[model samples]
Target: MENKMNRRGFFAAMGKFMGLAAVAPAVLGGVFSNQANAQEKRRSAGPGASAVAGSMVDVNDPIAKAVKYVEDFQKSPASKGNKCATCGFYAKKEMHGATEVGTCTIFAGKLVNANGFCASWNKKA
Candidate 1:
């Protein structure tokens, strides 16, 4: 009877171990995958992304071209009276080189000179 009891106990423990073994890899893989994704985000978020600075949009960028974005307001006659800083779509102003830059809603994830003007400009309320 004792022998039978010991065998049953061992089998129970073995069954539990097997269950854990089967499930452990999947759980651990998910944990590691999440960590990797988070690390990638942090790594890719370096220079181009900052609380004060963002990736600046170039005049030649597709969106910039579509919106007729001009780094200098004077360059675009229609943009003469408008400035990005006064625009409803611009925010997060930070100094970049000699001029201040801000993020424009029309050009997500990028910065535009505070003096820059775009066709999408709207007077800030």
Candidate 2:
């Protein structure tokens, strides 16, 4: 009876160890694959991927409203030193996925047309 019990215990331990060994490689492989995929996504997005969060404004559409806003700022004496490139509200980088479109901090969720302008423009200090 003692000999039979020892044999059964030894086999059970061996089986558990083998099962863990077999699963280890698959778990490690999955982790590595996930890391690789994350790296790929980061590489594709580049540095300015989050510059715009949503749909981009159409350049072909009339931007009179946006342009007028910029023109008003330009005419103001206080805005003499301000420009789209320097504005806090201006999107410094082109929108990801749509290089032609720009983004604006004030416009959240909407990509501004590259040529579009708005009243909230402010120079980056």
Backbone clashes, each candidate: 0, 2
Of candidate 1, the 10-residue stretch with the lowest lDDT total is 44-53
Off by over 4 Å in 2: 51-125
In Å, residue 4's CA in model 1 sits off its true spot by 60
Q: Per-residue alpha-carbon lDDT of model 2 for 16-124, expressed as tens digits?
A: 9999999999999999999999788656654544633567644343553454444224554545555455666665444545444545665555565544445556656
Each model's C-alpha lDDT? 0.82, 0.59
Clash list (residue pairs), candidate 1: none
User: lDDT of candidate 1?
Assistant: 0.82
Off by over 4 Å in 1: 1-53
Candidate 1 lDDT tens digits, 5-85: 999999999999999999999999999999999788656545434443457889999989999999989889998689888
C-alpha TM-scores of all predictions:
0.56, 0.43
